[model samples]
Target: MDIKQLQADIAAAVRGNDVLKCEVQNALDALSCATPKLKYLEIHVLKKDENINQFTNDLQECMKELGVLKGILPKVF
Candidate 1:
């Protein structure tokens, strides 16, 4: 999806119910794993790249703050 859509999805997921705890943790871990690439993207990409970085940062923050909204997939439900 697009950056704005992804950002909105991540925000909504972050505020979802507590059943997503493990997913949240996984998301945080995923962000950590992508940190280097994200940095590279910031350095080499254009203005559109900024949107990705912003979205990723927001996702990372949401994962960190909510702690229960990462992988709330059908398997969990």
Candidate 2:
């Protein structure tokens, strides 16, 4: 899965509907749904990204994880 696509899809999903003066409301809901997972992911990513040989594998794993996270996300946003 493309990380950029994931990001864009999330944006699209949340903005699925728009309310006057509340354009950010859906984004807020997306953040509420994703922030905790992002925090959890960032910790592991921080540690693994530092290792030269670990970058590729770690990234692939992260993508899989992110896919799962995304699956359950934005839907509620």
Q: For this target, which candidate reaches the highest TM-score against the unseen true structure?
A: 2
TM-score, candidate number 1: 0.30
lDDT of 1: 0.82
RMSD of 2: 28.7
Which sections of candidate 1 miss by over 4 Å?
1-19, 46-77
Q: What is candidate 2's lDDT per residue for 1-77, written digit by digit as tens?
A: 89999999988876774453376877788889999999999998887766855877789999999999999898878
Residue pairs with clashing backbones, model 2: none
C-alpha TM-scores of all predictions: 0.30, 0.32
- Expressed as tens digits, the lDDT of each residue in 1-77 for candidate 1 is 89999999988887775558878899999999899998978777777788899999999998876665554554588
Clashing pairs in 1: 23-70, 23-71, 24-70
